[model samples]
Target chain A: MKPTTSDADENSPDLLLFRYVEGDLDAAQVQELEARLASDAALRDELAFWKESFAEPEAYDTAHLEKSLLVPVEPRWTGSYFGTWIFILTLTVTLFRPVPVAMETRPVLIPAPVSTPAVADVVTEARNPEEAITRSRMTRITLPFREKRLPETIEVERNVNESIIPAPIPGIKSRPPEVLSPVAQLPLTGIKVQKVKPKPKPIAVARTLSRRQGRAIMRMKEKARQQRKADQFLKGNVPYVVPLNSENF
Target chain B: MRTFLKAGLVWSGILLSFACYGQVIPLGALPMQYNPAFAGEAGGPRFNFNLGLLTASRFRHNEYNLNTSYDQFIPAIRSGVGFSAGYFTSSFPYSSSSEGYKFSVAVAPKFSLKGKYTISPSLDLTYGSSATSWNPRPGTAKPLNLSGYHLLSRAAVLINSRKWYIGYSVDIPLHNTYQYYRYRLFGRSDISPERFNSYWQFGYTFQRSSESKFSFTPQLVFLTGTDRYNRYSRNSFRYFAPEAFSLNFRYGKFIWGANNAGFHLGMQTERVRVMVSNGFGRRGLVTSDGLGSDAYTGNLSFRYMLKQSRW
Candidate 1:
């Protein structure tokens, strides 16, 4: 074996041992040495002599470094040979253990999501519209509402049709600039114009809408409360009927 | 009996990695999910032979922050080139050729003693083609493909004694990635970062290999980066994670690790699991102009490390 280009093992009996530990030997030569050393005695002595040459830091030979570590030995290394062999054997097994087998086709790959699919469905969640209207009224005095207008071709546009007075009695619109007051020029609001009311009272249609919205909100809240109770019941004491099992625990 | 055999098989797989020649082959499809923060960086031979299999595959989330590379997982295998992910099955059986050759090396040859410190430095290298592809989903708007050659390496230190396990590793061009993800969407191939950088991983490890062939290693790693010239990470030197650790396990030739960091998690299963696993990438706090560069990251890989050295 060849010594490494390092000095960590210098002066130690194993100084050159690391050289062999380094992979300086060819496969063919290692095999040849394994067979020859098992039989040849004199050659083994020569091998040991060379091996002992670098036993300490006194000498570092390149020939041994580049060549084989299995030269014939005289009296083969007896300096705890058994222990070193065991360690080497153990290391060899650890390094050479067969890796697990892999086939071409692998198992199914399952994807994991950070956010469950249910989460992205927020905007489309099941909702009680009636409850939403009631909550909106309670939360803020002002709403982010835009002006609504009835289309010219339609009359049931709740916003536009319920605004001010209707267009001049069909055709007679001959009012001068100073003739009519600003209030009188405005379109009439409500089903019929009031002759002289103190202030505009709530429209019947609006009152009806308010009532419906309130009821819807109350029902939504009640439903939510019931759902909570049902969930708790399921989790706390989930009772089950025994099925077709022969044995009982 | 199956458990023991599985353990033995994994152990043998790990041992088979030590041949001085030939290609860099992983012991099994799975190997220890390692972090430079805890592993000794001195490049010698780190053996895991006789360790049992980590039956728990490296099935991990592709969340980068939740976990480190040690927590990624290998995909389950069947035959040929077909694979199943979730409910989707894709196979490229027409050309059963490999993406490309991969080369991996781990060298940690220190057995010497330091003053009051048992120091072991190791070097690890991995470079190969990715075995998976990144498809452009609807409106993703990406062009970074994880194709072509990738290289990652580290030189690190592991100092340990009776009570504690401390480690540090300096990563070099170890994770040189040449990705081409989501190219069609962007109308151009993805570009590789021309800069080089080094990352350091420091952590505590609990290794329990005593006298048995099977052992478990749990470690917590703190990672930091320096020298912006490397340019892998856009941010300056910093560290995060009050609770980011990796649990690496070995059984025979099989090894696995799982890590969770913040909201991201990852897993790494090697050898018998044969993979370069980096999947399940979820959106993080960071936003990008494109999905390819933002979605694809380096993580949870299963690789074969082949090594040879001269004394």
Candidate 2:
């Protein structure tokens, strides 16, 4: 049926009729809708049809409806055993492959050692005895002896006069001159000469120090030992002493 | 319908071209793989499997990788385990080519915060072996065989919301020993051990969801790490060091399908500088004449969700 007003308009008579039936219109609009409904047979018929159609439907069998609307689902690849096996096999093969060895050639270089010349002034002065006695200022000799070992003896030749020989000093042990090719008498001057005992292999000795130096070295060694013991105890490597209980014992 | 067919044809052509160009390996870890907190944040029990092929510009071969994960959300806990496997071949112009394979497993647990935010932390353990066949030299009768096994580990954290995510991760080497076997003399020699190295990554992801057809994710990644060395006797070779600043940008698209299944296509570009220590303390890039190099990668991923009723 043709309507009096366009359906697109919100204020159309058709919408007003529905609102009137729903009791949503105000008093004046309801009165106007009622007057229009009374005048128009088509409006009365549309309203009656609308009321019938909008009424609640009768009971129906939902069991059949439920069965007809099921959604189709495809099986997933991950659901299969073969897919799982493929993943496992891939992981196993990738992690267990054989490793390779690397090789390369590299050059090695070795360095040479350097040499120094020996000093000659000390060797020449020891050979002249007349000059040595004139310059005798109690020179001391210090041998390089290993721990607890006796120092080797060295012999020095002298003129027959005993006073000409240097006196022995403390901590510097000196051996008596041994006569090699027994004392030779000079024909005119009546002077006696003795051969040095091959210079006693020419022992290499350093300059000497006093007896207090030896005592200082011993004290330093004792201090170092005590420090080592204290360190060991602090490091828990040695047991520390604890006071024992006593009754004025 | 004609437009749809044309788009399909174009995508197929692009895929064919990419396949011919070999694989493009992602230089850094993906957010889902590195972050535990991002697990199962999509609001369902889901399974994901992805396969990727990566090729680098400096290397002539392709690398193939496969990853799978399954996660479920419960009132009490959110947990998932992931497995990944990869095989790669690398060739140098003047040196012998090498092939390697690796397998990794990750365990991730997620904790929900305030029903909107999630925190996931994960640990990954990986093992792999590689072999290099030496080139024949004038004095050598046969090629020397060089092989090695390596173990790697990663610890990561991710904090994510429905639309954004932030994550950090550290990847380190656990075992760095290699062995060399001389075939002619039947002698074996051990190479210098590799030193501890850590590769770190900080990333942010932004997601834009679509109602029906497509979704998009844009990500920014910052990568940095210290120098790593391989020691032989008293000499050491520095292999890789982090650049002062490096960044990666990734754009990903998701095309939806029936029953929550979708195809994910992503493209990423990265520029990084690696300090490589040659013998005698010299350091530079092996791939580039300059100090840094650029890498481009593409990824295609697929996911299928089995709904509760179907399960």
Best by lDDT: 2
Error of model 2, residue A118, in angstroms: 99
TM-score of each model, in listed order: 0.26, 0.37
Off by over 4 Å in 1: A1-249, B1-101, B114-117, B131-146, B174-177, B180-218, B226-244, B247-311
lDDT of 2 by residue, B1-311 (tens): 95575466446534632452223222222224544433444334445544444344544443444445554444244454555666666454344567777777666676645333457777878788888766656245566667878777878876654445566777665664443232213332332223323333343322222111222333434444433232224444444433211122222221211100112222211111111001100011112222123222233433434433110
Question: DockQ for each candidate?
Answer: 0.00, 0.00
Cα DockQ of the candidate 1 complex = 0.00
The fnat scores of all predictions, in order, read 0.00, 0.00
The alpha-carbon deviation from the true structure for residue B24 of candidate 2, after best TM-score superposition, in angstroms, is 4.2
Off by over 4 Å in 2: A1-249, B1-19, B22-24, B27-33, B36-77, B91-95, B136-141, B178-217, B228-299, B303-311
Top candidate on TM-score is: 2
In model 1 chain A, which range of ten residues has the least summed lDDT? Answer: A240-249
lDDT of 1 by residue, B245-302 (tens): 4444545444455433111111223222322212112221122213243233222222
